[model samples]
Target: MKKIKITILFLALLQTFSAVAQSSKIKNLENQREQIKKEIIEINNLLSSNKKEKNLTFRDLEILAAKINIKERLIKINNDQINLLNADIKSNEIKSEELKLENENVRKDYASMIFNSYKSRLKESRIMFLLSSSTFLEAFKRSQYFSQFSDDRKKYSNKILKNLTSLDSINKILKDKIVNKEDLIKSNNAEKRDLSNERNNKNNALSSLKRKENAYKRQINQKQRQADLLDKEIDKLIKEAIRLSNENKKSSTFSLTPEAKALAESFTKNKGNLPWPVERGAIIQKFGLQPHPVVRTTKIKSNGIVIATTKDANVRSVFEGVVLSILKFKGSNLTVLIKHGNYISAYKNLSKVFVEKGDNIDALQIIGEAYTNINDNKTTLQFSIFNNTTPLDPYLWIAK
Candidate 1:
């Protein structure tokens, strides 16, 4: 009985841990799904609305591809949840069988105990047995035995009832798990269908893009030139900034004053604590080299990340800085360069500017609103961070 109870307790604990683990994983996957969903929603709400907003550009195709990929991943997670449920149900079924068998054995043992006790009492009544004692000491011993026998019978009956109760509880839990498992399967199938539909949508978008291959290539070239021009201008401005910083000190490096050094150190320490340039947007184009979304063989180099945001959305500084320059080039939106000690953060593609050169700005201060390209039907901000003229990956510096 002790071993059987220990086994049941161990199984119960194991089941609890297994269930908790599966629940945690499922919860984590659900959270990831929600985040992706939010990103999709933001993209759709902020972009892809105008008549020119068909799936004709890389950004549009990228969004569709991302949506399909996320849905597929969501389906995979649902399947994983269903698999875990199936596994748990099967394991519990085995445990339930073992418990039922043990309960039956306990019932039999309890009946045998009762029968033996009855037989002993019938053969020699308790009073008669006490009276049959040869002496006082013998009577005393027989009386103690009678009491112990009664207590043992009560204990045996209680143990049998407890085992039966446990068995019933296990059976109920198993039934519940089975029902839950069925529900998970249904949800899994639904997600799979959703995934299939997403894939179909992706195919349709890709087909639309494929139809305009030549025109799309020319558009890509034009956009690439624009990006290259932006990069060059930003680079030139940063070099000029570095030169200016070093001019007074007659050195190639920035001469940090006491306050400047402290601020620089603080900014360095908060590498992953900086806020985003826009409050709500998705990083459509990440920093560094990326393959074209439709033309896989074509490569594009980016000095910064492009955030697609709502039209006229305010662009804010990620950190405290002094405005160094506001660059305006033909065929490009306004760009603001702000310096924080030896570091510089650049906000580009603005329809309006609120800050001027030499303005001291606080963290998350709105410098300008993002530019909305009327012809392209796009609204986005290009953000860059530099450590003294050296480009740093913006993602490493921004909060997730």
Candidate 2:
């Protein structure tokens, strides 16, 4: 029965667009920041375990560099949250001011009506007003008028009360927003401190690494040859698989059954949404060419992403497909290839194989345990997905 609803309709309509959009954007950013923070913690723990090594290995530099990258991103996210909270605080302050003005106007009107009502009641008592009517019908109309007038006054009074309540609610919300913004500022400052510490550690690591230039170059060269060999072997095995698939058919690539074709379609549809090959690993090496994280002049290229994990971590299948072949490099163990119609996913550097070459595997199924190198005291998985013999960047298909 309060006209406050009508008065505030415009304000409500104006906020509709930003309400969900701003809240959800902030929530999404916060979630991402938390995930990256957890990853930094994991990487820190992993790197700390290797601190007792006689030398600061290139792998150590890589891990430290990765941590620095995440820390930088984390700081950026914190700043973004603070910016968002500031915008929200400003928006709420404006809305609160509007509500205050509206409340004031409503109170003025209610007070005027109350004053006028008292004057009328004093000038003409209800019984006197009713008896003053010339006829019975007129007296009955007069009584109805008085009743309606009382109801109108009560309704306006209620409106004023409702407006006051809304103003109070707005004030409360503004206070809460101010408090939240303060909390965010504190968090942002704390992250900035942590970032500073990481940067210092990075500088120390870089200085130590620069002292062993030749040793570092040798490590880089060795790793590059291994990667090149792995790539060659992967190409060879996948080409053979495609050849076998096309052996009986006129198709240049694999001739698929209807079900296999459908499965491939589904897998393609889930690009950027596919599960990661390993549950708990950070992508130590990314797809495509980039300057090495530690060695600025040196370039590193990867057809697929390399995920570093705990020793003997589970290497899971990204999609359901039949295993094609399990090949091995000289040092690294078996690498399993799975075929889903025209698409193939490769999981390399595996220590122990779980499924056979011809076994039917489901999505997220554990294909093998990643290799643990006693020399470096590390475990890593080189995961690649292919469309026939052509390599695809594994990062594109995997979930964030």
Candidate 1 accuracy as lDDT: 0.78
- lDDT of candidate 2 over 1-400, digit per residue (tens): 3688876886777678777799898898888888787788788777877787777777877887888778778878877887887888788778778877876887787788788879988998889989999999999999898898889778877877786787688678778878877887887788778778877987887787687877887777778888888889888777776666678454446777899899989989999888988888777777888888888788888878878898789989999999988887885568898998789998888889999988999999998999988877888888998888778998788876
Error of 1 at 127 (Å): 4.0
Question: Deviation in angstroms for 261 in model 2?
Answer: 4.0
Model 1 TM-score (2 dp):
0.66
Worst 10 residues of 1 by lDDT: 46-55
Give the lDDT of residue 281 in candidate 1: 86
lDDT of each: 0.78, 0.83
> What lDDT does candidate 2 reach at residue 124?
84
Best-performing candidate as measured by lDDT: 2
Separately for all candidates shown, the number of backbone clashes (residues 3 or more apart, or on different chains) is 0, 0
